[model samples]
Target: MLKFDHVSKVYKGGKKAVNDLNLEFNKGEFIVFIGPSGCGKTTTMKMINRLIEPSEGTIYINNEDIMKKDPVKLRREIGYVIQQIGLFPHMTIQENISLVLKLLKWPEEKRKARAKELLSLVDMTPDYLDRYPHELSGGQQQRIGVLRALAADQPLILMDEPFGALDPITRDSLQDEFKKLQKKLGKTIVFVTHDMDEALKLADKIVILRGGQLVQCGTPDEILREPANEFVEEFIGKERLVQAKPNITTVEQIMNPRPITIMSGQSLTEAITLMKQHRVDSLLVVDENHVLEGYIDVETIDQNRKKARLVGDVILPDTFAVEKNALVRDTIRQILKKGMKYVPVTDENNRLVGIVTRTSLVDIVYDSIWGDEAAAE
Candidate 1:
């Protein structure tokens, strides 16, 4: 556990990074520090590991004052990953991954095994161990840097925008992977990012900083549902209120469940008719259990009418869809990417529970942003 008791940091020119901050991080808790650039998020993280000592106030790790501890020893016990990766070009991937283990004088055989295991954990092939840092892609190299930090088996991990440089798709995959790894290892993690979306997706708790001060600290749902102040709410944007969150929300909140269905044995014409009649873009094809077979789009029906095929011939299976409880934010993100107006939401039984159209999703987001006025209305 870590605690910041009235911590404050001022630079040589009297610039304050953090002001009278009081915070507590429970054991094995993953906390994210997020805000605009220069808001002292990184300053707070570095103070924990002693990369930058506070100008005033006390920082405690395990209830003991951190300032009294040896900086080098403290850093050795903390895993750190920065945005630039900073891997040594002369070192092979294996060496990079095992840097800490080697420094700790791990046995040659053990270091090799640890490096191999970690490389595989980060999705690097076994053959990659022999290659140098420059041989890998930016994303792969970033993974290596992160794996390197964890190689030492540290109790705390500090990550500052670790995935900021990667493409959106790669960043998303890495975020999911990090979540899995964290769940397995359960380290006390302090992550810093400017991205609200990333903070929401990965953080167990979010710490929002503004103008060198703590604004709010709470779980993702807590912060999203009840922002602490006008600044916090405005910073996160009122738009997130109705922002569709299908990943954790329900179809009933944003679905047109009664407007769409597909017959087990009907021509494309019937499917098209059903969609047009209901004013929906797609129809759900179901089996005896009301289990969803797939989705039949209006375009699919129209293009294949000459073949006398049933809805099953062109239904998009669950493989191409997401759960009904998926965050509507992510759902709308994907829809916007394809410039589509609809997404299917299914239940655990794989039944076509309901359909979420763009209009519905928009309404949710709109409501989230403007709910204050709506309540008054």
Candidate 2:
């Protein structure tokens, strides 16, 4: 949906911020632009909305040249998000989110409804609509920034390190959340980040830049498997290269085939006994046919013990799980990135087959990194 044709941006001096970038991004694709300082990733993204005008060549959005359009009107039709969040502290969350809609002269009731609908996408409650930006956490504020970008339902969005200021845990959560949202909405995104992990996790295609030029552009796996040059290889780092090796093992190979589990119909007393016997804080709840239902933990059981009887009554049904045939790398990313203790593995029928724990991953990672050399030694 976005194309960069022989694009070049040169400041007043002889410095070229972007040098002849020729690239095209497809619709609904998550495109990440990444590089070191002064590499022109941000400059390239800003040029999309005419925030930074190109000194040479043309940029087209769906075959319409962006430079030909009115800069202000073009910006309004596109979404832009920055690292600083840029939310007005005085404005309520609803007002902040609907800022663009208000500019479009949308009716008050329509704007309010839009804000509510957008907030629901991130699982935020309607009560937040009336609260000011200062009342929300930093992560929540960043979320608001994203919502503001999506306020007008723009087909293309530009994000310049939008999560750079957040803590690592919050950043990972937002990355996962935003990736899911992008898939659901199917908006073409041009994101700028220096973080390779973030680029790999979020981008459908990665555009790596250096010295104000495109060094390499490919999927994360492609770049990892066969880096174009020494610069690209070094930038990707050796650890990631090793981790992305071809013929990588699958989750089923490393997962524990028999995890501690209990029937949904089992009594709370029985659940407690099972937990104690297995020395586990929780037990996976499965049906008689071994289909995954959910899970019950010691804390959950204790909290509901007085009011609840069966394991099914207290089970938390929203447990994150993985398919048995999933790649080990993906499973590791899900568990480590989300900070989960373990992820249950299920078969095609949703039957509980196994579980992968953090400890198991640690061993597997060590082996992947040094097993051959260690064996030789």
Candidate 3:
């Protein structure tokens, strides 16, 4: 929806902040600008809404040059949110949020109604609308700041690290909430952040810049699997695959869902029979409840072949474990940390659902990047 065409910006002191940059932001695409502090990302963003006019080229919004439009009118159409939040201390939450509407000369009743709706949309309560900005938590205040920017009902929004100041947990929580809000109200967002992880998590298209120039722009997976250059590779690191997501991969998706099973009190012969029938190595015994009791692998059964003990008698609880919906990296890290062969997959209530062995993870990674048929070949 917005395009920066060969835009260049030089300050009065003759320092070049943005070097001839040509970029296009797709409609409703959550694009992120990331780089070292002096890389001109901030300058590039500000120039879009004419907060900082280009010294050379121009920017366009829907084929209309922004330089032609009145700055105040252009700003009203493009929401602006900065790191400081800049909430006016003198006004109540409702008053602060409704600042744009009031300025637009809307009726008092209309402004008040909009104030309530926008506040609620950002997940803040109506009761807080009467309260001052100082009365709310840092995160709450930041949320209010976002809501206020959104109140203008603009087609484009520029957010400059909206949650950069919060603690990790708070920042993560707000990012999640913001994601949901964006889905419900699909506005074109241009966000600037130093946090690569946050950018990876949220960006539909990530724009990397260095030394006042564009480096690369692509989807999260694209950057993760294939970085543009040596610098991009060194910057992103090998952890991108793991860092791109949190605990979301289903246990069943990465687990050996079907394992050889022996009855609660089955004999060693039964253990061997189950393993052979399933063409597997172990006999996993579970009671009627489906809770993981224990396992008797082929090695154990072979060692005690002459004894022929019941599966329960030979079962060992030491090898059992459960981690549900764990990230593949987390799963492998925990498994390697404990020096274990397999980890069970359980629901939130901790009942066994499946088992994730080292084999399962490798298979999953292989199947995902390369096709299943390709892997088979």
Best by lDDT: 2
Which is better, 1 or 3, measured by TM-score? Answer: 1
Cα RMSD, each candidate: 3.5, 3.6, 9.3
Q: What is the TM-score of each candidate against the true structure?
A: 0.84, 0.85, 0.71
- Point to the candidate with the largest TM-score: 2
Task: Kindly list the per-residue Cα lDDT of model 1 for residues 223-320, writing each as its tens digit.
Answer: 88788898887777755644623233644566777646776667777877777787777777888777777667777667777874777777777534
Which of 2 and 3 is ahead in lDDT?
Answer: 2
Model 3, 224-248: lDDT tens per residue? 7678998787777655554333333
TM-score of 1: 0.84
Local distance difference test, per candidate? 0.82, 0.91, 0.80
Off by over 4 Å in 3: 241-377
lDDT ranking of the models: 2, 1, 3
- Model 3 is weakest, by summed lDDT over 10 consecutive residues, at 241-250
